[model samples]
Target: MRAVVLETAGPAPHLRDAVLPDPQPAPDEALLRVTACGFSHHDALIMEGTLRRGVTLPRVPGHEVTGVVCGVGDGVPASLIGTEAVVVPGDIGHRRDGGFAEMLTAPVASLVPLPQGMAATGGALLASPIGVALRALEACGVAGGETLVVTGASGGVGAHAAQAAHAMGASVIGITGSPEKAQRLEGKPWLDAVLLDDEPWEEVVAALTGDMGADVALDTTGTSLGRLAAAMRHGGRIALVGQTSPDAAPFAPAEAIFRELTLVGSLGVERRHVERALSLVAGGQVTPLVHEELPLSVESVTRAYRAVKRREVLGRVVLRPVGF
Candidate 1:
């Protein structure tokens, strides 16, 4: 097996590909032939040593994974062999070896059967962030005829949240930092409107919602919470999922009390959320946007990490491990 190993963490971390023996499955695990593995911004944070709580050294740091069942241990279904599956990202990429290798082992219970006709790299992303989006939407309780606002709507999680919220019948408004993203989201069927992040979002939301304000807001950019709250109607809900911005959002305690706002912190996804997210993909209700696809190699991996770290890409970036 070939794997990218992050042996040390620093301001300038280097990931090198190493040759190793194939991984064997545990009694309750299955061995998968890696197909596609995608990168996340969190992967950059882990490599940079900023988010180092659960991350261990000499690790393969990818969680968005999809592969074919090549082998399974005792008590696991033999029929799973040759089946395409997605591994829901969790402690695997954080604590143990992950999908950067040619083959990896995962608990059979953690594997989700990949739906037919879905792209492998897209399946990899649906295994992780899309599920997080579903959980955020559930936290905010978006419903039909309501207005939902999403910050950082051009990024992976926010993009998926926008699609899911719209598919569920809510009117969506996306907030982006660039005019290009705003124009892009404005043309999408999922978003009813698009606003620049620098704009007066509260006033825009009021006008867009006929002075009632948005019923729910998913704050994908953590620093926009105060403005998001201001754009919400009284008793509205805010689902927070990211902490990308350095500064905290300024919101008065009196504002929450007077508006009777419900603020919810969505951490990660559960198994059920993964299933629902994939179903959306299978049904064509949501598209997992991949900004770039690189062959799995030492050089490509380095470039992928750089792109993710710099936030140069619009959506998810993935790696093809099988052919490469």
Candidate 2:
């Protein structure tokens, strides 16, 4: 098995490509011939040495994995062989080796079979940003005909959240720090408006909604809790979905008190959420969220790290193993 290892973590993290023995499945696990893996900010953080908890050096750090089940261990059904699936990275990428190689093993319970004809590249991200997006919307309790604001709307999770909310009949407003990204999210059939983050975007939202503010706020950037609260109408709910930074978010307790605002923190996803994400794709409810795909190599991984750090990536960055 050929793999890329994070040999060291620093301003310039060292990456080494090595050939390792193929992983064997445990009693409750399935051996996966990995096809595609989403390179998430979580993976980038681990490689950049910013996030250290549950991570060690020289690790294989890819969690959003899509692969084919080549074999299954005891307690697993043999009929599952040759099934294309997406693995929910439970403790795999963080606590142990993950899907950064040609082959990996995932617990059978974490595997979600792909719908009939879903491509491996697109299926790779169903568990993370897509499933995570749906979970956030459920946490916020967004309903049809409501005004929903999505911060960092060009991002992986935020982009999907905006589309899914739009599909659910909500009027969507998107916020992006990058002008280029703003253009990409603007004028979309799924998005009603796009706001640049150069100014206090909460004010823009207030103006756009005739001073009533948005009915729901989805905050993908963890640092903008206070701003999101300010952009919401009374009794509006805010779902904090993604954390780009480790710092404590600035929030106004007064808004939650006098304004009767609801704040909810959401992370990870359940099997039902993944199933919903797949359904959305299969039904064409959401337009294709094209990812920036690169082949697996030290150079490509480093390139991806820089793009994510600069917040330039529009959607998820996917990495494909050699031989596709």
Candidate number of the best lDDT: 2
Model 1, residue 76: distance off in Å is 1.2
- Candidate 2 regions exceeding 4 Å error are 247-249
Q: Candidate 2, which ten residues in sequence have the lowest lDDT sum?
A: 285-294
Q: In model 2, what is the error at residue 179, expressed in angstroms?
A: 0.8
Q: Give lDDT tens digits, candidate 2, residues 1-324.
A: 899888888778888888888888999999999898888888888887887877876788888889999989999999999999998777767777777788899989999999888988889878887898999999999999999999889888899999899999999999889888888777788889898887788888999899998999899988788888888899999998877887977887887787799889997888899889889988988654755888988777888889999998988888899753
Clash total of candidate 1 = 0
Any idea what lDDT model 2 has? 0.86
Model 1 agreement with the true structure over 51-121: per-residue lDDT tens digits: 77788888987888999999999899899899888887779878879888888999998899887777898
Candidate 1: C-alpha lDDT: 0.85
Give the alpha-carbon lDDT of every model.
0.85, 0.86
Question: Which pairs of residues have clashing backbones in candidate 2?
Answer: none
